[model samples]
Target: MNSISSRTFWVSLAVAFGVTLYVTSSVLAPFLIGVAIAYMLDPLCERLDRIGVPRWAAAGAVLFGFFSTLTAVSYFLIPFVWGQLVDLVKHLPEIRTALMSYLQPALDAGKPHISPMVIERVQEIANISTGTIVSGANKIVKGAVTGGLAVMDVSVIFVLSPIVGFYLLKDWPELSSFITDSLPRAYEKKILALARAIDQTLAAWLRGQMVLCLVLACFYMVALTLSGLKFSLLIGLLTGLCAFIPFVGFAIGLTAALVAAAFSFDTWTGWACVGFIFAIGQMLESYVLTPRLIGQSVGLHEVWVMFALMAGGAVLGFTGVLLAVPTAAILRVLLKSAYGSYLESDYYTK
Candidate 1:
């Protein structure tokens, strides 16, 4: 083929790929989530295979167990969460009242020093923040359950995701090999080494993060329940699950927990206990769980991960958000390789 024609063909393929993603973005969430599930389960599948389980059977076993647990949770756990959400929404006024009760003493004490304008602004900020927190949560959860788009997405997750995951899990090795084989010969060896490193490290990191989240969730649930938190189960689970989102999850969970604490407790000690639970959770994650599970670094910074997620969601909806981190990690790896080459070149030697 002529060089120009070849260039056109490649460009056309890229355009087609982008167009396809845009067209199918609405339905891509379940499929993308399935892909992630398959990737995460690949190690387990491999382990089962090594112990005399056929690859297909191993894939089936793992996927079945996972989806079964997920289905059970959707059936039983979700309704409980919904109930907590409803109760939380109902208690929002009390949370605000309690918050003001605590704030009023300080406001009165500083009334002469703090202008009325400042006091008004402070009250407005607190009201809006708390109101937005629960209201936003209510809207998102309800929309996911009842929205027209939600039906299709949720159905796909139930019916289609397992099938997608099964095939991907079973074919993982061949798929990896095929990708490596498709690279150009000139730098194939160099790239293959980098690819393998990326594959191992990235996979380990993702799997570790999943484990970390689960561990944190269980810990929070138990700890909060013991502390007599009114919505201990709800707060603990939220805190645990959200642990994966860097600071955002912790912030949402902590804010909710603190509000619940203020409303539920008469004593400052109960309030302090609730605050310490979150403080301990954060410290545990930073000093212990993260270091042991995901190592000290995973190439992608917190800011970059947040940016990628936001940008991806903005561009491609839920599917984009799901893929953003892995895609960013891959690009960072490649860029690092290019940087190394540049340093060795005469251009850099000068």
Candidate 2:
């Protein structure tokens, strides 16, 4: 086939794949999660294999360790989070009273013309209730049911992940060789170089971000706990997790901490402490955690990162969010290549 025809065919194929992906996204979440787990464990499995462990055994060991760690975390963290949530719910009346007291003066001063009935109705609707709790529980149950369905649909992927991982680990070297062998000899070196660059970028980003999250979580927990904040563990864990979403995590965490602190202490001192803790966390993240962990890897702008996250969330919900950064990294590589080609073209020179 002519070059033009080949290009057209590849472009059409890509479009078809994208369409299929979008349509099948609901069932794709588990498979994507499995793939992410496999990808993260692949290096460890390879290292074990290199030291004379069989590929299957290495894969099994890595999978076991991974799941064990997850189980341990869930055991401790889940209950902590649950308790915090229950406590927060139980104290809703006090929180509402505190908020009303804080806001009433401002409302009165700012909007004298506003009707008291309208304000009271707004407050009543906003008030936390048993019905709200029940509604939340119902939503959780519905979500769990849907999640169960998705799990059942993707059961094969979950069951097969370790199996697939074993072979992939064993054959990784051979697979790379096979791909390189199949590529056009003229472009083989270039393709390999590009692949290595992409791999390095992705690996650095993943490992660095994870470490940053953990460190930030610890910092948050210590600071908030010292500040006498209620639900410190839950807030800290959430703040750290959300930290991955750029500023959104810190903002949510700070607001939640401030509210909790205010309710707990009923004074500006608590609010001041809340602010100080977050300021320290932010300072550490900006000056210490990010610089030390991420370094100069994956140079995408914060705006672009935010856009990618939002786009991914819109496209595929949580799974999309998980995949967003890696996908953006790959796109960055492709864009860099295209730009380089354009720069070298005769039309550009003219």
Candidate 3:
């Protein structure tokens, strides 16, 4: 094909893929999750295969290990986390009352600085907000309906994702070979280089982040539990999961720990301990965990990562969030390559 025709064909293909993704995003979540799982486990499967295990057997073993971990979490961790969640929900009113007690004084003090008429108008609005309340109730009802459907979706994913991962892992080698063979001869070297770059960036980030998250979760769980905080496990798990969002996880986790400390202990000693634990965790993450693990392999700036996360979430919800980092990594590689090419081109040289 002529260069123009080739470029047009590629651009059209890209547009088609984008449209397909947009249309199927809702159903793609589980498959994407499975792809991630399979991607991570592919190396292990390969290692096993090299050691004389059949590819299918190696994939089966990995899947077995994955399920075992899930089963363990379901049995031991879920119950404790669920119990804490229920207790937290039950005491939310009390927590709110406690918060209001502290906040009310500040609000009251500020009220005197504002116009009396403004205060009166606000009070009147608050009193006549029944329609707002009804509207909120309707939203709650709608959310509940959405949640019911989400639960069904979750059920499907829970069953399907592992199976998807298993098959993907099993056939990964064949798939890779097929794809590599299908690439155009002239562009094969460039495409392979980009693919390898993507693989390195993605694999390093995902594996390192997983390890980092697990370590942080254990640390938080133990430290908070030792400090005698209520709902420690749940809070720790939340923090660990949110670790993907950079500083947000620590901020949220620290806030919860402080609240729990304040609620559970009257003295400043518990608060000090809580603060100390979090400070130490931060130090470990900053100085030890991140550098040793994720480092610069992600190849996206902190700001870029944050933007990618927000944009992904806004566009694709949870699935978008899951895809964001990898997408960003790939984009970074592509952008760098394109910029390098541009710098060498006649347009730049001129």
lDDT of each: 0.83, 0.78, 0.83
In angstroms, how far off is 185's CA in candidate 2?
4.3
* Clashing pairs in model 1, backbone N/Cα/C closer than 3 A: none
Query: Model 3 clash pairs?
Result: none
- Clash count, predicted structure 3: 0
Q: Judged by lDDT relative to the true structure, which candidate is superior, 2 or 3? A: 3
RMSD (Cα, Å) of candidate 3? 3.7
Number of backbone collisions per candidate:
0, 0, 0
When 1 and 2 are scored with TM-score, the better candidate is: 1
Residue 305 in candidate 2 has what lDDT?
Answer: 75
TM-scores for all candidates: the values are 0.87, 0.85, 0.88
| Order of models, best lDDT first | 3, 1, 2
Candidate 2 lDDT over 1-350, as tens digits, reads 78999899889989998899888876676566666677778899779877999877887788888878877988977887777776776676676677667766766675667788877765666555434744675566456447876567567666766566556665666777898898877778888888887788777777788889988988888888888889898899889988888899999899878767768786788888888889988998889888777776677656777889999999888768877988888888878888999999997999
